[model samples]
Target chain A: MIWLERLLAISAKEARQLARDRVTFGMIIGVPVLQMLLFGYAINFDVRDVDAAMLDQSRTSLSRQLVGDLQATQVLRVVREAGSERELRELMQRGNARVGIVIAPDLERRLFEGNRPAVQLLVDGSQPALEKIAQGLGSMPLLKRAGTSATGVRRFEIRTEYNPARRTAVQIVPALIGTILTMTMVIFTSGASVRERERGNLELLITTPVTRGQLLAGKLLPYVIIGLIQTTLILGVGRVLFGVPMAGSFVDLYLGALVFIAASLSLGLFISTIALTQFQAFQMAFVTMLPSILLSGFMFPFEGMPAFAQAIAQVLPLTHCNEIIRGITLRGATLADMHVPLLKLVIFLVLMFSLAVTRFRKRLD
Target chain B: MTVAISARGLTRRFGAVTAVDGIDLDVPRAQIYGFLGPNGSGKSTTIRMLCGLLVPSGGTVNVLGHEVPREVETVRRKIGYMTQRFSLWDDLTVTENLDFMCRIYGLDGATRRARMKDRIRSYDLASHANQRAGTLSGGERQRLALAAATLQEPQLLLLDEPTSAVDPQNRRDCWENLFALVAAGTTILVSTHYMDEAERCHRLAILDHGRIAAEGEPKQLARDIDATVIEIECADLTAVRRVLVTVPAIRSVAQLGNRLHVLMHRDSADPERELRASLAGQCADARVERVGATLEDVFVAATQLRRPDVERAA
Candidate 1:
């Protein structure tokens, strides 16, 4: 009973202090909403309307039809017409166009002879995603459309699942839940211990009967509620604006989020014990945040990374959180299927909690 | 009398510097004990060690019959510490700070409510109960801090330079409150450099350079100082000071208004006569008379004028 009373006392104090801080209160809600909109609408992997230069070596109707067919795919637009291949190369070098299409002079003859390829598609290799899209044009059945008997040409069918429309917002919106939670929850308690020490409150606090566990738990309570609210805001905005389907149960998502939030706060508290000032705490938090954003499979493919980098990403909480959240939100996964990541999060929470408590000495040095 | 706090061979070092050297102390029950010293003289450090807020590098502390850094938890329940700085949450209101402290001390609902009301009224904080602690005046903040620290009514209270930021009137009022607390059978250990405040203590420890130079009642320490005091009234006090500095027996000389207060080695049989003999030819009009030693003289003898050679000879 006494422990509960002390815990409540510290929690109430922290809540009052946070309420009076206008900037922090505003940041709690403002950061999630702003980052959600910024990352959702601004990032697109399914590139379209790439500027292209065309070189027509032959004035036949067949060349015109070939150019029109490439445009019909909506992947490239003919912004410039080049008289020579060198001019098309210069156009790409000057950054005016990202793709180039050249129709050979003997296109009709080459189609009949079948000795060499009739059309050549040149793309700027600097943008790899655009290059992949431009290469897909090579597989189009141009001769078959021209009333020629098409011989043996290998064709493969590609189907994109979950996100059938290939909307970037769909992928980004669900994963934003994990990103936003990591950003806010890690920073919330990072400065807790340093701030108390800087304000001279630690001296008086340690003299009282409150234990370290009670103090840490009390400070973490309010921020957990704040994290849940931010989660709700992101989900609501994502559903209404982006039309991202809720394939999973809300209860399962929130449960996973609860474990992730606890783990992040424990890491923050551990950092708080290590930093001596608020500024240092913020810098250390940023150090963790940069890796969480870049290596958590948020913006990049996790498996495509080098072995060492993937190993680094495996240790980040957001890495597991991203998998769990994306699985539940887009793949409609149940908690039974998410036991591995959930167990990892629980282990991280315990490890960080013990580290923070052990590092936080009851007496000042 | 029961000892409220006792320490032996207490020492703390910060790398190359020793903040509190090997020291021994015992604070008795229900008395206002004071530590008088200048800045960097280990007053705050000593107070922190006594309250178990800081662990000593070497030595032992037994506070409230419980050994520190071992039984620190039990000792914490019986002690209240007010830091040199006002450490209450500045964003919280006066009432809120007291309420939080009350809850932390495990006071029941009825007792907490009653104590809050009582403290607000007694500390003259009823009018500004809702105002934030940061917005209060320095004096008001000190009062609020004191009120908050005493909410648990612990057996011992450790205050570190509590009145340094307060005005004279507020300082007096604070001392009155301290006396009241002492009368209620709560032992208080206060540290300050103010001589007037030190004089009010039942016992005083004069700290110097990480060591206790002298310890006793203020009046007793003054009477037992190792220097002879002689006041000389002269028209040209500066000239008198210049002449007195050349005398081998004189330890220190200070100008007080139009007179010169001279301290000579206690080995001099007649300090007043010796001072008059030394100034006879230079300025015969100087009036030399024996005077009683003050706390300032005691401080100078214990800290500034007591050289290594003099200490060895004594």
Candidate 2:
């Protein structure tokens, strides 16, 4: 019974202290919300709908069909139709299209004679991932058409400009920005609360009749809200300023951000509970954040990485967040489509949050 | 007759270091009990254990009749702890801090608000109710800490070095509030390093190296040592110790500023005769006078006996 009183005292004290401090409350709420707004809009992971211009030397039905197929894929939207290859190159240089497709003449003669036809694709390498995805999607229908012809007529050329090979930054920037916000919000709030404890203000709080559960919840709630705000901001900015598309539903993106926020906050709380000082908290948070970014597929493709990296990614909340965010934004996937990753995020939140609460309460005890 | 706080052989250890060794303590309702110890001598540890902030490694601690650790929550609610350092929310207004505390304690809306206001008024903080706690002076901050701790009207109040940094006037004022609480049937267990603060308690225990070296009414602990401390002023201190050390009754010799205090048992060392003889033989002019033993003397002797190595290490 006395133990209950003590818990109440501690909880009450924490609530009181937090309620009274406006800056801390702002830091808890405003920082995360601002970051969410910043990150949600500013960070985009999926490469979609690249603006394109085309040069068609053969104005035949075959050329039209090919152009139509390219447009049908939804990966490329033709911004301009060029009369000559020179004009197409000029358009590409003038930033008319990130990608340019050139179809050679005599394509109709080859089709009737049952001989091979030639085609060429040009892409700006400024963003390698988009260019790569564009090239892959650009070749799909032509390759399928050629496969149907048994007469050795399946030949095409794909030439990429700017970035000859897709670089990592095209895939990394959108997610890296979000992950950075997550790291900052979680570490800041967790360290702030723990610093108060180390300074012994926590004792003043415990003697006031607060429950550990209430205190922990109160401390975490503000950060969660803040994390959400950061997600919103990042997504908004990512879409508008950086041309990062939000192909997925806002709700789907939100759910993903929520899980990520909870996991990060809980991890932070866990660090705070175990640490003796703010420096220790910072060290632990950095340690957790570093591995999270490295193994979460933010810096590397999960598929390209070795099996060990894949397995490591499975255990990190960042891995699931990255997958959820990328899947939703890139594939326009619904929540149901992200069942496995969403489930993983849920389990991470529940387990990590429970453990953090247990450890934090135990410290008071 | 209510025993507001009780501990029997309460022991707490930090790994291999026993912060609070086996000890017994009891405080009747309305009594002020003080714990006196130097830094790291287990004063704060004992207070924490009593307030249910820390669980004892061995034995039982019953606060307000509730067993600790098991009923820590209950014990915690019943005790108000004002820690040695200022612990109020620096960014919050005084009223906000108090209200938040009340809310956490589950006090109802009207009651919580009214009690917070009353506390503010009582502590003479009404003018600063809207001022952030961080902006308050040290004395005001101390009052706020006290007010925040007492918000729940706890039956057992535990104050650990509550007045260490406060000015003399504020310290006296803080003590007055403590007395007021005691009169209202609150049992207070306070720990301090100040001799004057220790004297304010109804009963006190001097702890040294995690052990209770001496405990009782301050006057009684002083009387128990029963050493007639004589102040001797001499030009040559080495010659005085040579003559005084060999005396069978000279139990302790301590220096106080420029004067040397010779503590002698009543049976063997007569201060009047021995002082005159030593002065005539030493061939130096010196003045010696017997003085009643103060609590500081008793504390010094008890602490010395508990840790002889401290002196050797020094």
Candidate 3:
């Protein structure tokens, strides 16, 4: 009961202190909205309007038909025709085109001889995402369906489930809830704690009767509220403004997020215990944020990355939270379906809080 | 009177460096105790150990009859500590800072409110109650800090260089408040680098290189230093000092105002004659006279860098 009273006392004190810092409070509430808009509209991995050049050397009626086929997919728009192979290379080199369609010189004669002429799609190898998407367009359904129906055998039918439209915002906006919370939570909490240590408030607290557990818990409590508020703002904006669906129960999202936010708060506290100055704390927090954004499947699919990167992603709190958010919002995942990630977050919180308290000495040493 | 804090063979180390080594201390109740040392001499380290903010690398510490770092919780409940740097919540108002500390110390509602009102008046913080602590002037901030530290009526107060930032007027007022606390039967242990402040303590300890060089009343420390004080007047006191320090019998040389106050080995029976002869032999003209020792001389003599042979042995 005494520890609880002291916890409440320190929490109220921190809340009052943060309330007086108008700029910080404004940023805490404003950044998520700004970030949601920025990431939701701008981060589209579904590549479109790809610039394409046609090098139809044959110039025959059949080759003309193929050019129309590429354009019908709406992904690649043929913008130029190369006079020769050298000119086609020039189009790619001048940055005028990202994809090039090349047809053989004598396709009809080669077809009559029963030895098929070589046709190729040359693409810019730079920008791996653009390269992969452009290559996929070359093999789009327009080309495949026009070439063959192979009516002799039967192939199994495929069906897409949950996010059948493959909307990046549907996935990214929900994941942004985790990212915005991660950045703001680490920035607000660790920055505040390290500033106190630098300014001597932490030292003063150490001399008080408050235990380490109470002090850390109290210091992080205010930031947890800030994290929750930020999470809710991002989520609400994501659902209403961006049309990201909330397929699962709100209770599932809230309960999952509580554990996820605790993990982030504890991570920040661990960073504060190690950082001697506010600058160091800020640097450390951002360094942690980078991995969360890159490896959390927020920007890229987790399965698409290399196995080693997947291993690193497994340890990050943001990775699991990203999965939890996307699963609940996009897949209509229930609380039962999210136990693995929630359990991971809980385990991470326990370890991080323990390490933080153990590393945080009462002495200046 | 029962001692408020007592330590025996207390030691603290960082890697290979020993900060507080084999030091013993006894601070009595209802008295002002001063800790004096030069930079890196471990004054702050000792105060931290006594407050149970730091663990002794060896030996033991007992504050208010509780073993330190083990019964540190009990000690923390009874003692209030003010650090060398400003430690109050900078973004909070003056009243909010005091309220926070009172709650942290588990003060109940009525007592908290009454003491908060009393300190706000006595500490000259009534007009600045709603001002953010970061915007306050240096002196006003220290006043707020002291008011917050003492808001709970702690039994023993530990202050580490509490006046290092304030102007002279505020420093005087701050010491007046400290004396008032002592009058109310609160034990105070304060560390300071100022000689004037050191002279104000009832009992004091001079630390040098993590060891207690001397401990007693300031005047007693002055009287007990084993050195002959000789003041020299000359056109070039620097030149005279250079010649006098070359003599093995002369232990140290320090310039006070226009003259040099030289300390010689106590065994040197003819200190004045020895100093003048040494200066004259080097063809430096000077006048020498024996002078009574002061607390400044005691500090210099107690912390004098010992010869290499003696230092290594210790």
Candidate 4:
């Protein structure tokens, strides 16, 4: 009973201290909302409106139909008209077009003559995503129709599953929940202990009847509440503002989120133990944030990264969290479908908190 | 009297530097026991060890019938510790800070409210109750700290340099509050650098280089020192000090206000005549007389044991 009371007392004190610090309180809420909104707009994977220049040498009805088909796809917008292939090359070089299409002079004549009409497509391969979409979108329809007309050999169709509209906001907003949670929870948890130690309030606490485990729980309880608020704000903004839907179990998503929050908060606690000053702890938290951004596959696809990078990502709690969130919001995955990610998150939480507790020495020495 | 805090050969070392060397303590219950020393004298270190905030590299410490470092948590529950720096939450208001401490000490419900109200009135912080602790004056902050420290109603209170930052009148008020605590049967083990503050303690231990050089009642420690203190009033105090230092019988010379306090060897039968002869023979006009020793003299004597000249005098 006394242990429970001690925990409650410490939790109450921590809650009051957090409420009194208005600036930190504002940041705890504001940072997640702003980050969600910013990522919703900035992370567009759809990659539309590729500027293209055309060189129609045949000038026939058939060539006109081919160019119309490319424009209908909406992936490539034909922006400029070039008289010759040389002009199209110049347009591609002068930054006027991301892609160029050239039709042979005898394209209709050859097609009616039972011979193949050769068409050339040029693309700027600087950005890999745009290159694949541009090439596939700009030529696929035209090639399929022309090839079917000429021969009956190859036949296949492309179908997009999950997030069929390929909305960038949909993809980004769900993942932003994990990224934003990681950033806020790690910073707030690490900063709380370090700030107390730096400001000398820790001396008063250490001298009390409070044990180390009680102190850890008390210091982290208010942050768990703050983390929940941040999660709700990000999810609300993502759903209302960006139209990001949650297709899976809310229970599953929040369970994963709870584990992720624990891992990150304890990670912050671990950093605070090593960092003598709050500023140093802040820097360490930021350094951990970097890995969440790049290695956690939040900005990139997990399957697309190399094996070594995936191995690195496997250790980061954010990687598992991002996967869990995306699986729930995008795929409508159940707890059974995401047992690996869910279990990994639990493991991360247990390991991180154990290490943090070990590192957090009760004595000042 | 029951011993509230006692230690045997308590020691604490940081790398190559030993902050608190082998030392022992015996503090009686319900009295103000002071630890007087200069900065780095291990006063704070010893108190921290007693409070169980630090683990002694070596020692046997028992506080309020609890063995420390093993039963430290129990020791912590029965003692209230106040550090030199403002350890309470600065962002919290006076009332909020006291309330927080009350909760931490497991004070609850109406009892907690009553204790807070009593502290707020006695510490003279009734008007400043809602104001932030950081915005309070030094004296107000000190009062608020004391209020928080005593909120638990612990049997022993450990205060580290509690009056170092406050003004003279506030210091006196703090001592008055300490005396009030004593009257209520609360044992206080306080550390201070001020001689006047040390003199106020019922019993004090003078520390130097992490060792206890002397320990007794303030007056008794002053009266029973190994040397006689002589006062010389003169125009040229610098010359008087310099001339009195050359005398073989004079152990140490210190200037206080308009008079030069010269300490003579304990065996010297007539310290006043000896000082008068030394000043006149050295062509300095001065009137000398043996005066009763102050705690300051006892402190100087205890600390001077570590000095080379004072060692040579022995």
Which ranges of candidate 2 are over 4 A from the true structure?
A1-181, A244-248, A362-365, B233-242, B245-248, B254-260, B269-271, B283-287, B305-314
**Candidate 4: tens digits of C-alpha lDDT, residues B135-247:** 99999999999999998899999999998789999999999999999999999999998988898899999999999999999989987987898888888777776676568
- Model 4 residue B124 CA deviation (Å) reads 2.6
Recovered fraction of real interface contacts per model: 0.93, 0.59, 0.88, 0.86
Model 4 residue A212 lDDT score = 83
What ranking of all candidate models by lDDT puts the best one first? 1, 3, 4, 2
Worst 10 residues of 4 chain A by lDDT: A146-155
Task: Estimate the TM-score for candidate 2.
Answer: 0.76
Taking the tens digit of each residue's C-alpha lDDT, what string does model 2 give over B150-226?
Answer: 88898888888888878999999999999998998888889999999999899999998888888899998877874
Worst 10 residues of 3 chain B by lDDT: B304-313
Which is better, 3 or 4, measured by DockQ? 4
Q: If you score just chain A, what TM-score does every candidate get?
A: 0.95, 0.58, 0.91, 0.91
State the lDDT of candidate 2 residue by residue for A53-147, as single tens digits.
88888887778887887777777788899888889889889887888888778765665455554567787887646665755664464534533
What lDDT would candidate 3 get against the real structure? 0.85
Give the Å shift of residue B259 in candidate 4: 2.3
Per-model TM-score, in order, reads 0.97, 0.76, 0.88, 0.93
Interface root-mean-square deviation, each candidate: 0.8, 5.4, 1.2, 1.4
**Candidate ranking (TM-score, best to worst):** 1, 4, 3, 2
